[model samples]
Target: MTASPPPADDLSPPPSCPDAAAPAPAQALQRLKVAPAEQPLSAAQKKFNRLLARVNSLERQLEQLQQSADALRAPHLQRMDALRQRMAQAQRAMAQLLHARLQRPGLTAAQQRAVRALLRDLVHAVPPSPQPEPEWAALRAAYPRPVPAAPSPEALQQLLDVLSAASGETLELSDLEDAGSPEALIEALAERLHAQDEARRAAAAERRARRKTTARQAEAQAQAQDARSALRGIYRQLASSLHPDREPDPAERERKHALMSQANTAHERGDLLALLRLQLAAEQVDEAAMARLGDARLQSLCLLLQRQVGTLDRELAEAEARLAHELGVQVRAADPRRLLEADLQALQDELQNLAEGMEHDVHALQDDDKALKAWLREQARLAREHERAAREMTGFGFQF
Candidate 1:
């Protein structure tokens, strides 16, 4: 038989030689690749995927919101700063004019009263000085009472009462007395409110931490072991496969090093979705494997995804709230940019009108005594009306 020589096409091995009939390594690998369309996702898997998508969507929205807010804030702050400077300069000029008028001689009682009222407004509008002004003593002697009698004892008491009611705490008049002036008192009140808010947030955080600890304890008594096992299994598989030190090829090892770093981070964070994504990226797992996860593991992963969604939701809300506060407008989900622009334009117009009005008042007071008197009379009438309204509202003269 050997001497006859077999035909060149006759390449079949003997039936007893099973090893000779084995497939090539490349062909064996091809057998392991399952078509994704073959597996239909279960309800739990679908829910997990949906939650993961929601988290991604929320994160993208937050990032875009931050970028948009920054873009709007830059120019808005610049323009507001310019307008504020102009207003400050005008206020200073008016203050100077009022002070000069108060020093002039031969003034009637009514004129003196008018000048005092205007000067009182200027004093209250300006920040208090560390040292008293030179004219302060002279004016106090001439007036026989505080000119700018703002934040009086009754006013301070009312403020304390309001704050106490709001905060559900008792506040006495002495609490704000250390501030020394109306402006300082107002600042002190603001500081107190901020401190109260911070305390409330801290308390809330502590409560949440306690609740989390209790939840973790409960989980330990139930399916915590299974959840931990699932997480560790995925991490271990990734670590073994992506072990850069085990790889000989330099380029492949470098690529794997980066992947290994990400895997380590996801493991430490207990981020199931991120680990799943990394596994998919490494071709270690496919959609079929993801869909076929154990019921307990799938449940844990779905819960994690839900929590991630909630956290992202809260973050997005806080970012939007901050933007709304900075813009001084209520930001709706639809067309927030347009709303901010409209509000900003209105603010600009108001500022322009205020500047014009201040300029007109300065000119009128400087040029004509009759104009000043007439303005003073109008102010008096307005004050009487305001006082009457206050009496009607509160049945007391509680200066707001």
Candidate 2:
């Protein structure tokens, strides 16, 4: 059998034996496929992933906050409007009672002073009549409205100094002397501020234009281009995979169409994270692939995400500010909805107490003269204290 051994080219054993057809060692090795080892994320890549996760969390939180704010706004506004109406009615009733008491004969000097003080407080509360009643006109003549003191020269100069320092321009009192009243001064200051703002904006624009032509700007442009390229690459991959036209099934095509729309929108907005998420959704890329991205690409993505984080932060701050302004309360960041609800409840309670107090005052003032006189004496004493305090504030150069 050895003398009759097959030639080198015919080395295979006969097919009659099961072991004769077994593969050679090299052939068996070739058939066993070994997967390449995944590359571990570098420090920068890990940082980028952390930032991405933070952005995702912020996006969800902001959306939820906005939804909650929207849901609370209508009810809050409605309740506020109702409370304001009640307050107005209570104020009108109080004003009418005071006016009637003032018209009565033999009122003590203290009572008269208290009535006038109450009337002055009601200036904003009571709607002005186009035609004054005889009694009201007489009452006005007896106790003419007090003229407010003008802003002192020192105060005006101080304001000018502050404005000059802030605006990087010289502001003299003579420039705003024509602004006699506080309201006029405010209007003049607003105009000056607007002009200064415009000047600053123009200067900034010019500086930006100059910067755009510099080497540093060129580097920035290059970096921006790289970031855009990374974003476009992900968007393109998503587009290719999720294009509805490529899908055969109706349901799959519709789904693809939706994803394609989302991808398009994300691309238009330069939302790199959103496009990357779309890539994940379509199975065009995985976390491992993302981690394996080149350093330059990862850096660009990180920069984009950093800017997104800044924008999200500003949006969150602005949203909270708006909510706080609307609710007339400071919004707590940790649990804004709960805090807003608590503040709203407190405000309702306060308004209720005010309404009840006003009602009780009306009844007391109408029925009991002795009680009313005692109240008037106390009010007059408080008014004197307030006037003294005002005089003291004025002495220190503070204006009302």
Candidate 3:
């Protein structure tokens, strides 16, 4: 077969390869050049930097608060589990007691009714087993059928109102009717009580605010306002400094764009530290002049710092209160790591005691049951003997 001729373009000479070690393009080199000499940071900029440091410190405080919250959460959850287990143990103990009481043979109809009434009195009694055996029949007769229906919204609201009145706290009226069981209703009522307590505290704060402010309080309020103004001024300065649209060079514009985005985010989040860091990185602030802030600006910064610290403290307090509420315990100076251990131990101890009591009760019940059975057998034997004696007497035709 004849080989096809090569294409015209394929015959052209290939281009020579450059040295692997060649320097980058001039444009890239220009891009890599160091930025222009830094300008001195203005008085306002220095104040901003100081405020940013305070903000960063506050952020760290918040982080530590969150960590404490997490630490508290684990123990609180363990305590809750312990409580649940305790409840289950209590239920099991009660069940065993009921089973023991119900196991007595030869119970009359009236006696069975009385056992059932006792079982019915227990609100959280367990359901009976479904076997046709005699032992199970007694238990089955005693187990109550508490097939609960969902409460109507109006009735739920009424119940919530009553609970709220009894608790002396505002109860939230939301989806409470969906509490499908009585136990769930109780839990919902508990949550509402907690919410109400928080609401009442807020109201009390409002009431306290109605009181005349002392001179010190007035001065502090003014300082707080000044701190807020200073923060706003610093944020505006950062925003103006990093306006990307004003940058003439594309590379500088790109850099400004990123910085501006960061500034915007920091402003939105009130993150003074991030904005200050961006300014420092961009060489917009003069480090040497950062310490040259005026006395007035320094005072303002101090006020800002005070306000920030107070805010952090308040947040931490709220977190602690929330944790305390979840654990159903007062957390006054309590270590977050070990807060729930005591409660859990107490509950476990209670459970142990309950279990022991139940065991004792079960043994006593079994002994009583054995005695009852023996007595019933004896009574039955006596009845049979009496019948046989009567039959012999009747066959002999003897008149009494």
Candidate 4:
């Protein structure tokens, strides 16, 4: 016996061909006399198609929900990410101004320490360092003679090798070989180590990137395979019920031939729902017959339906979660566009406030710097006068 037609729901107009042109209705009915009577669908087949339709409908609904959620989430995610970047920039700029203010000369050690402590507190509260240029410079200047870490064994050995090579006064490989002092040798070794470390890091990152790409490709292939499997199952069911070669009546054969062509096209395109609907249209299954199906077949149909429902449920849940994360709220079935607009407005307001604050802090720091310079100049003038007076008193030979 031929396999039964696949379950149906995805409906589309079958493309027309020359063979699709129908004869007169009277002539077609007469042609049916010589053909075998059309068989009524069994109770099992009808029930299976009905359950399949329900499953397909649920799947379609879930797909639409996911698409809608993604559509709503994409812009909001991009906007939020952009706002985060801008906020970080503003915070970093403010930190730089604070750091620069603390850098002015002539403050007492305690006063300098207090200012630095305040800066640290503020930075710790909302740290944002795009490049850390200002912060690193301040650190370096504060500890110009910071205790140096001892050279590694490899570095020491490399230094020794360099010294041995340079021991022959006439031999010189490069300017680096001429490094005679301990500091010079250490610097050369440090440079070499740094370059090697950078190279290793680059190689490691490249390998990780390759692995990620391979994983993504494998995931895509798996999804494609699953789609093909689903379409194949649906196609098999459709072919069993609608094979034109099985229809002996010329008129019925012509009609089945057209439907079979449509089925083939839908299967090729991986349109499972279309195949299901086509089978339903051909009267391969119906509602009343579904109610009379055997227990075994009904149970099998139930299992397929349950599987479809589970798949759709998982997909829907993932889409909902993604949307909620993007919006920073537990969104349900509400209109997402409106909610995202509200979030966008709040973010814009925050961005504006941060920009104004950054600008004000920058101006204040510049003014403070000018005042600091003036104070230092006045102190210098006072010292010069005191020195002149001391010289004059000494020259006058006044003994007190």
Candidate 5:
């Protein structure tokens, strides 16, 4: 009997890879292939890919959130989150558009409205620009309770008016809550308002984060400018003094010229660390020439930095010495600056207390051991004396 392979219709579609945005069409049609179906893919595979794109889009949004310093607004966090959910729903709608995967045909109509609502919220959160005077006046007037909130009719109407204010657009409202009904304009408008609120919050957070970043960058740039200005002065002074033109010997002058060139290059390149090394190497340069180039300002800056460095170094050395003495062990210098009083002070204090406790314990143990030794010796002496007395009493055979 010839056994036939089981029909391909019995096989289920393979699980889609999450990372794959587009899978091979050949693999997708295997289940339906039993019927001589010529289509390369089935509806399931398309649906999965659309879902992946939606999720990937959401992740990009989260990444944007992380790169920002300002998070959700306090007054509208919950509202914003709800707005985000709507946006996710909107993304689902987008996936449906790609895959044509909606289970219910009527659901598509409602989903589309929801998508618009989400967009409305996003728009409110991050408007293209500030509102016109009349629009702002309307918005401010509509949300009357000294604050704005959901179900604020004035606010809602005002928002509608703002949207309408754009050239030649008519926005209508129906009073029902069912998004499925095109006639239910109020539900659609309310949904849009919620989305707008979320969008507004997201925009506000983004603006705050942008301001903070700009401020920080500005501060760093200012400090860098100050440092470069100071370093350039030092380099110029050193260069003028060491220039080969001042050298008496031609051979020596050429070497000095090379060093001066290196110094100038180092200064231009903002290589402070290299400049320090060059300063050490420039010891052979003429002393009189070097001194003539010195500036009071440059000297002042150097002295200030040196004084601070010296202070910190001395403090660190004292800390290291104390730590070494307490440990009763040679602790190698782990740092060039040694230990400052502020660095690890809490841990050092705890270590000091622990070391003191250990010493006390050692003294107690020594005292206890000495007392035990003395007691043992006394007991032995008494035992020997008793043995001697008994021997004297029993010595009648050798009586002398």
Candidate 6:
């Protein structure tokens, strides 16, 4: 076979070794694959690094959160701040409403009195707090608070107008309803009576609970006092036994000295329970109360708190009085304390009136009930007499 000359290459240079410059198509493909293979791995490494960074950030956040939670474990000023804020908000709203009402000219002085009366009535209906303040504070800590409803736009405007008219001017009214109208009076009396009854019941219940708490505290205090008295007796006995002066021996003197020191320390520290335990170990019992008079921690704390409250109350009162003096002529205007006192006075009056009205109502109801019972008894007696008469007529064989 004739060997044909090799066909001339067209439109391209001769293929070069991939190691030099140009590469075969297969080698080029392999090179491209190598870079992509590295790319996927690099992407995975980047993702892993991001994941590690996120984990580290979360760890830091968790540690911070733990520290914050631990900080909240103690009672904090923030709680007091929040309470004061809420109280301030309520006060501001009340002051604004009053100011607005005072600005309105159309409202009469009596209508204003009536408005105060309504506010007075409503404030009393908030119910008396029977529990201790600390207990109430604790309950408030856990309990969900009620959200106040927003007033309707029209009602808000009306309130604003009424408040504006009420400021600085006197109110006057006419067409007063007759106080002697039985139906109207009865309805009013009934409502007042019911409210009064509730208040009395509340007061009585409070008095009872307070008595129980006081009794418990008193008993606990008595026990502690007795323990302390015993401690003194024990101390006297121990001191007699451990007197360093009585010990002629040097080492025994040192030992007695130590015991005496311990006894003194314990007595001064008021470790009555420990002292009592020591007394029991001594195999001789003394009348705890007869041993000596002493103090109780619970009673002491109660006294301390009472004194603190009294002092704080005096300070607050003085501050308020000074403020009032400064605003003497305008004390009623913008006096937070005066408003608080007025509110309190109004509530007391309402509660007293309601209680009296209820008592009267209850008495009246009881009287009516007694009258009805008497009438029933009379009717019953008449029926019996008629039956006897019928029986007597039958026995006499007479037809009427």
Candidates ranked by TM-score: 2, 1, 3, 4, 5, 6
Clashes of 4: 11
Pairs with steric clashes in candidate 2: none
Q: TM-score per candidate, in order?
A: 0.57, 0.72, 0.42, 0.40, 0.19, 0.19
Which numbered prediction scores highest in TM-score against the true structure? 2
Q: What TM-score would you give candidate 3 relative to the actual structure?
A: 0.42
Backbone collisions counted per model? 0, 0, 0, 11, 7, 23
lDDT of 2 by residue, 81-186 (tens): 7777777667767777777777777687866877887777764554455775665556445556677787788887888788778666786766676776545766
**Ten-residue stretch with the least lDDT total in model 1:** 11-20
lDDT of each: 0.65, 0.69, 0.56, 0.57, 0.43, 0.43
- Top lDDT model: 2
Per-residue lDDT over 1-400 for candidate 4, one digit per residue giving the tens place of the 0 to 100 score? 9965433332222323223233332332232111222656555455555655555556555565566566756776676677666665665565566567666675666556545554554455453356667754564355334356877757766766776565532323354447765678557766766788899999998987777567777765565565455456557666776678877789878787888898898766544445545545654433333344444544444444555567666666776687667667665443455665566567667776766765555555564756544544554576689888888888899533
Off by over 4 Å in 1: 1-43, 105-118, 124-280, 284-286, 324-335, 377-400
The parts of candidate 5 lying over 4 Å away from their true place are 1-219, 284-400
Which pairs of residues have clashing backbones in candidate 3? none
User: What overall lDDT, based on C-alpha atoms, would model 6 receive against the true structure?
Assistant: 0.43
Candidate 4 residue spans exceeding 4 A from truth: 1-61, 105-235, 240-275, 281-283, 322-400
Task: Estimate the Cα RMSD of every predicted model relative to the unseen true structure.
Answer: 12.8, 13.5, 22.6, 20.4, 42.7, 39.1
Of the pair 1 and 3, which is ahead by lDDT? 1
lDDT string for model 1 (1-400, tens) is: 4656433222111212111122332332232222235557666656656766665567557666777677778787788777766775576567666677667765688778777866666555644447776765454344343645465678778877887787666877666767775567667777888998999999998997777457767785465555566677778877877788988889778878888898898788666666665565555654345444554566666666676777777777787688778876665433556666787778777887777777678877884667767877887898899888987877665555
Tens digits of per-residue lDDT, candidate 6, 302-400, equal 333333345444444554465344322222222344454454345445545555543443344332434423433554576689899988998999765
Worst 10 residues of 3 by lDDT: 10-19
